[model samples]
Target: MYRSHTCGELRISHIGNTVTLAGWVQTVRKFGSITFVDLRDRYGITQLLFGEELNKQLDENPLGREFVVQATGKVNERSSKNANIPTGDIELLVESFSILNKSAVPPFTIQDDTDGGDDLRMKYRFLDLRRNAVKKNLELRYAVNRSARNYLHENNFMDIETPFLIKSTPEGARDFVVPSRMNPGQFYALPQSPQTFKQLLMVSGYDRYYQIVKCFRDEDLRADRQPEFTQIDCEMCFVEQEDILNMFEGLIKRIFKDVKGIDYTEAVERMTWEEAMWQYGNDKPDIRFGMKLCNLKFPAHTFPAKESLSSLIAGDFAVFNDAETVIAIAVPGCAEYTRKQTDELTEWVKRPQIGMKGLVFIKCNADGTYKSSVDKFYSEEKLKAIADAAGAKAGDLVLILAGTEERTRKATSELRLEMGKRLGLRKADEFKLLWVLDFPLFEFALEDQDGGGAGRWVARHHPFTSPKPAHIETMINNSPKVADLDKYLEHPYAGIKANAYDMVLNGNEIGGGSIRIFQRELQEKMFAALGMDAEEQQHKFGFLLGAFEYGAPPHGGIAFGFDRLCSILGGSESIRDFIAFPKNNSGRDVMLDAPSEIAEKQFDELSIKLNLK
Candidate 1:
């Protein structure tokens, strides 16, 4: 019962109304004996005036920053109004007040524009939460949750609770294990996602299910990734891929409308995985710009004349001749690039991760002149012909990368980003959504393949995905061929498309899911194709297999990265800004200093050994 009305709820209409309000001291302005203290709370701020009458009390008990106080005052209109704040036109004429709580001096300023670094802010997160920017972010996160929940509830989806400490099965990421003290030497893993449980819910005849749940992944972190994150997980039974897609699309549209007030009327564009890779050199392509890499050495097309080759491809450029794939990128209107600029581009490709041997360039000059790194190899006619083939006009530059397939693709992606920066194409506010579908059913990891990939076909998506109808016969036909040493599994796994789809937003994969195989025989086939023997399958996923036996419905769903989605909606690149308490790059909770070792007694009870290297 600190106050009747909130600081933000007062306005000119409440003038002459006696009220009591309490908040932390934001700022204090003094001119001679008259004093004004800005009292702040989560709602807003109000200026409290202490006249000569209360001057002795105010002077004796000085008001410092962040001191929580209770003040009973009469609300009055301000003589000089502030146009900036909502309560600008009003001030409180204090009748009486008392200090409730005092705070020690904070480590950093609690203003919206405080010049505090990430580490400092994270360490003093309690103080940081008082900043207006952080407050707004937290409020926006709440709004997102509300909008999502409202939408789901209105659409007949239940907000179900899933267990966190569940049995561990390997997904793509590493599990965070929790030791069970009650059961010695046994452990329970924090769920990466409620994948199995949600599927079980579908078997229990819950047609639509959703959860705003925490998921854990003990993996290396990136700018967009965290060790622990939240997902707006959802699943629906007896629905096709189209139904799931449309439902989620509606949810996204509703969120945008409710939170951002922007109408995304256009239907989300769809592109096959092959098309995305071929056109943008990435499955999650940023479609805002178009400097698409064109394959120059495609065997389908006839070789261009020597005039085209003379630029770089013409003569004895052994790199291009020896390359399995030759790729080129067009830089619009950069034909007059200096030697230093050209060298910078060359150095960019030679980064350790990209691993390109070198970058070759053909600068198409005005007046029909040309300059190139490989000018020695190509004659003028060949250079012009090559420029023509690249569709490079005068004042354009064509960069070519020639190397092994892997190196060339990586280099091409990096080069695209560079050109994107130059062209001012990667705008943060502008969003481009694309659906990338038709991913391969299996991938050949070299180490896993060394084990003869026996029974072990790695999921290109996941083992739950249903193979495309056209590839079912092919998969069955080749299943046993690999078992026989005399024969080979000649059926290309790359061509086998899974019933999978990924939603990409501005080059980040926002969400992905696939139509799951419901039939037990199909599930067994999928496991066997991944090289899982009957015993191994039963041991790892015996519960799921048993659940399928009790009349499971065909189900599929997608989980949106709620943090990342909110970050994008809040106009920030990093998800850390949207999350309330985020960990550092190395996954340390700076505030709590988590992951500290426990006492020996606790470890003994759990039967865990701490073997520090």
Candidate 2:
């Protein structure tokens, strides 16, 4: 046998037992004639003590970091016990040892606090994985995986396999296509999710089905996104929106209990998409701390009934007068910010990411007086009114941004998050769950590639999502064409809500799903609304459309982003730490040096030619 016990398995209770251990040498230290080595394996680390003879053997063949070795030793209590490790109270007095393999010096230190840059660490990912930090993340990921599988199995969800290569029906993101060698002049796109297949499973009378599946998207990359990722894709038949919500809520809570030992007893909060946007300016708002958006001069059309304080700065300030909308957030206990600090904040907003001309602030002083950047244009009373409108209290600072509707709202949201970060409000350990519901069924695309949209509708979530029960008639009756571009929001299609829900943790969208359109007529109308005619519908989703004829039951399901969920649970800002071999931000595998040139003969076999423009 390679070993009688693992490096981390022995303890003081086994002090008299002789054991054989095999692992990599984490560190080697020598004092006079005795040597100490920390042997590390997947389990844990155990210290080893070598006598004079073995220390002389070490001189002939020195033990280095990350050398594979096997040692037979008598377990003994340590003279210097390491309180940090579980196997610290005891050490192995090595009787004999053999060096199985010697390793070249690692590019980076294999420890918790390593001396390596991101690119260097990524290049040597195998060594990076040996770090305690990375190992814990992967362990947590595995634990979450087991928890999810156990929960799903207990709840009667069957694990099913789905296709990787499928038809490309691009929606929000582009597809990563693969050329088919057998079918020349054509290509297959990787499944973005097992969306349609899971729906087909429901049609196949598999009421409960699930897959921890791989999905690909040719999209912009970010901290939370990947070109290829995993999803806990699931579907169910004979279920309603409420049923799906309750079931998945239980699954998430179970995951918390099983993996993190957190009860998560509090109910997951809920908000309409409109409410989320209006109150926080983000669909996935971080609810750990609240600095809700305050609308002052918003466009009347977006929130027609939303009260506005536009008149507060209407008269003399050209900045307020010329701007389309004004939005603000109150930062608690920041009223004493000096002029330089506020100027730095102004410069912060003007950065390219924020894309704002400047920033305005109202200091709600403790002495019942208001000081503001726009004091020249408005009286002290007007300033106090604006501050009060934003729910700013005494000693609170109200930060305001004004611009066109979309940019200003987004900028205000970014500003709120920055202030929260600065004040240590967005705590990593404090998780909050939210369900943002009632998203608009169709988003109006200004103009689509096939000369269709500006004038046409696109699915807000996906084409198959069912409209709200009350909005079904409106969706079927309306033409979905925008005769007047400026007044597109006035269309009845604009008001129709989807039966979709997104599960938000902290500030990230970790899962989303919708009740599907099960009726043929309604499905057809949804296709037409998305600028897909009968011929295009047949070409794209013909199989799904035909499945509806075979007694497809009412169904709904959700897919959790497996990576994002793991990252959030692991208290990480980036999903890369949880993923085993994640691509860098630009979607390149630096270790493998992938996305390289393929063989010309292979391209010829697929009858493809590259026009590298």
Candidate 3:
């Protein structure tokens, strides 16, 4: 046998026991007559001692870093134990050794704090994985996966495989297509998520089905996103929104306990989509801190019930009065901020990402005084009123942003998160879970249709999502057309809400799902609302619509972003590190050098030609 024990297996209890160990050389040190080497494997590292005689052998063989070696030795207690490692208490006193293989010097040091850039590390990812830091992330990822599977299996959810090569129905994001060689001219698109098949499984009488599946989307990449990613996809039959919520909440909590040892005893909080947007300016708000947005002035459509503060800023302040929205948040203990600090904040919002023209501020002084940038537009009393409306206390600074409704709200959200970061409020160790419900069933899609004549309605989630029970009639009866662009808010479809919910954790959307339309008529209507004609719907989703005609049950399910969830649990901001062989930000596999061109003969056999633009 190459080895009797792993590098990590020996301990003080095994002292004086002769054992064979095999691993890669991690570090080598010489102490005059004696030599020490650290042997590493996937399990752990163990120290090995080379006596004067064996030291001569090591010198002749000349062991280097990452050299694969096998050694037979007696386990002995270490003179200076390394408390940090599991195998610290004991080490191997080598009697004989063999160089199993030699290795070239790696491009980067195989250490946790390696001196390598991202591209360099990615190119040498195999060497990078040898680092303890990266190994721990993968280990944690596996633990989470195992925990989720165990929980789901206990809940009677069957693991079923789904097809990767399926029809291309371009709905939400672009699909990555694979050209078919067998059926020459046609192509197969990868499954974005197994949305249709899982529902079909429910219709086929499988009460509970789950899959730790790979999903693909041809979209822009971000820190949390990849062209191909995994999901903890699940579907259940005869379930309402409440049942799915409870079931998945249990799944997440069980994962927390098994992986992080966090009990998470507190009940997850819930808020309506409107409430989340109104209070925090974001659907996925970080509830660990409390800097809720205050709507000073906003459009009627945004917060239909709340009164606007037009009267308070109804002076020569054109920036506030003319803007479609004005919003603010109170930054505690920043009332004495210098002009330079405030200027820096102003520039922060003015960036193209935030897309705001300028920022306004109101300082609520400790001595019952008020100061503001718009002092010429309002008096001390009006400034105090504005600060009071924003929930600013004494010795607090109120920061405000005003512009178009969408831009202003988004900018305010980014600003709030930035301030939260600056104040050290968004802690990685602290996790807060929330559910944002009652999203709009349809979002105005002026940019989606050709010619941009008048915006057509598009499904906020998907065409399969059922509308809220009360709004079902409104959705069915009203034509999803806007006669006037200015009065689109008056359309009945604008008021309809979906039976959907998104689970947000620490300002990131981890999972979302909605009760599906079981009836063929409602499904067809949903397709029609999304601007799909009868023929187009028949071409794209005929299989699903046909299945619905038989005996589709009331099914609802959610898919957790498996990578994002794992990263969050591992206290990491990027999912790439948690993923093995992940593509870079440009969706290029640096190690494999994938997404490359095919041979001309292969392309011709597939009846394809590349037309580079």
Candidate 4:
């Protein structure tokens, strides 16, 4: 055997016990006659001392860093214990040793604080994984996985395997296609989620199903995103939205208790999608702090007897008054912003695709006076009214954005986050719970190949979503005139509401799922509403629709982002830290060099051609 006990198993009680241990050499310190070697493995590390006789052997056959070895030694109480490590209280007195394997000099030092850049570490990932910090991350990942499995098993959830090679559906993100060798010219796309299979499992009488599986998506990558990722996916039969939410909420609490020993027993807050966007400017709002945007309308004293909104709208500032919608925010205790700071805020809105023209600011002085870009356009009375409208107290600064209504609202929201960062209000560890409800059923993003120009309409969320029963009549009968630019008006399918819920944490959407349309007719109607032809529906979700015919139970479930959960738990900004082998920003596997040209023979067998652009 390579070892009798793990490196972590030895303690003071194991003194005088003859032990056989095996691990890679962590460090070697030689003191002429006596030599000390730190033997390390996944479990832990142990210090091994070689006496003078063995030291002479070591001179000829010297050990190097990361060299694998096996040793038989007598455990003894350490003469000088290290308080930092668990196995520090004991040491091994080596009697004999053998080199199991030798390692080439690693490109980078295998230290916790190794001086290696991201690209270098990724290229030599094997060596990088040997670092204590990297090993600890992997260990934490295992602990999380084990904890989730245990929780699911205890809750009577069955672990069912789903096919990785599955049919592709053209709905959301692009797919990673795999060419079929036997069936030439045909392809199989990877499972985005086990979405349809889990639903089918419900129909096949599996009351509960869960899989900690890999999901693929071909989309733009971010620090927290990857081309391939893992999820704690699950589905439950005969359950409502409340049932799924309560059950998964418990799962999260259990993970916290088991993994980090933190108890999140309190009920998580909920917010509608509409409210979340209106108040925080994003679907996944970071509720950790408050710098909420407040609406203020009307210009100054000389205009009308209306309340003044000089901070946002002014006679001279045509940007705000000219726009149909203008939004503003108040930043507390930052009334003394310098010209450089204000210029920076203006430049921020000019980033490509964000599409905001500029920003307006009003700094309310301590003595109730205000300094603003639109100050000349309004009197003192007008300034006070505008300040009051914005809920801006003395010593507070009010910021404003103006453009097209949608763009202005979006810009105002971005400004809140930016100012939050500058004010140190967006704390990661401090979680703020909220429930955003009451979302619109449909959103138009041009027609899906039906080609109706601005008159086209589609589901805001998805066609499977159930419309609010009260608004059903309005949605079905009314084809009212709606603006093309601001497409928030009533349409043929505007009243639907998916039985969906998203759990957001620390400004990141960690989980989202919806109660599916179980009825075949309803499903078909949904497809028809989305402009899918009968043939298209049959080709895409025909199997799913057929499964519903076999007495399928009403089911719903949510998938938790295992990586994002761990990232939040570990207090890291990027989820890649939790993922063992994550790809870089460009979706390239630095270690493996994937997405490369396949061998010509292999491509020919699959009847594939690489039309590289």
Per-residue C-alpha lDDT of model 1 across residues 24-80, encoded as one tens digit per residue? 999989877789999999999999999888867888989889999999989999999
Predicted candidate 4 versus true structure: per-residue lDDT over 1-613, tens digit per residue: 9999998789889999999999999899999899999999888899999999999999999999999999998999988999888999999999999999999877888888898988999878878888888787777788889999999999999999999999987546788999999999999999888888888999999999999999999999998888999999989988887898888878877877888887776778888876676567778888887777665653221112444444434566566668755667889999988999889878888887567877778888998788887777777677666667777899998887766656666777878888888898976666544444446666665445324244455655445555554654554565434555444433444444556788877787878777777888767766766667799899999998898899989888888898888887777878787777789898888899977877899988998887879
Instruction: Summarize candidate 2's per-residue lDDT along 116-226 as a digit string, tens digits.
Output: 999999999988988889999999999989999999999999999988889998566788998999999988998888888998999898999998888999988999999
Error of 3 at 543 (Å): 1.2
For model 1, what is the error of residue 363's alpha carbon versus the real structure, in angstroms, after optimal superposition? 3.1
> What local distance difference test score does each model get?
0.83, 0.91, 0.91, 0.79
* Candidate with the greatest TM-score versus the true structure: 2
Q: Where is the poorest 10-residue window by lDDT in model 1?
A: 299-308
Superposition error at 472 for model 2 (Å): 0.6
Q: Which stretches of candidate 4 lie over 4 Å from their true place?
A: 297-312, 336-356, 433-435, 447-455, 459-463, 468-488
What range of 10 consecutive residues in model 3 has the weakest lDDT sum?
445-454
Candidate whose lDDT is highest: 2
Candidate 1 error regions (>4 Å): 298-314, 365-369, 384-394, 448-456, 480-490
Pull out the clashing pairs in model 2: 446-454
Candidate 2, poorest ten consecutive residues by summed lDDT: 446-455
The candidate, 2 or 3, that scores higher on lDDT is: 2
**RMSD in Å for all candidates:** 3.6, 1.3, 1.5, 4.1
Compare candidates 2 and 4 on TM-score and give the better one: 2
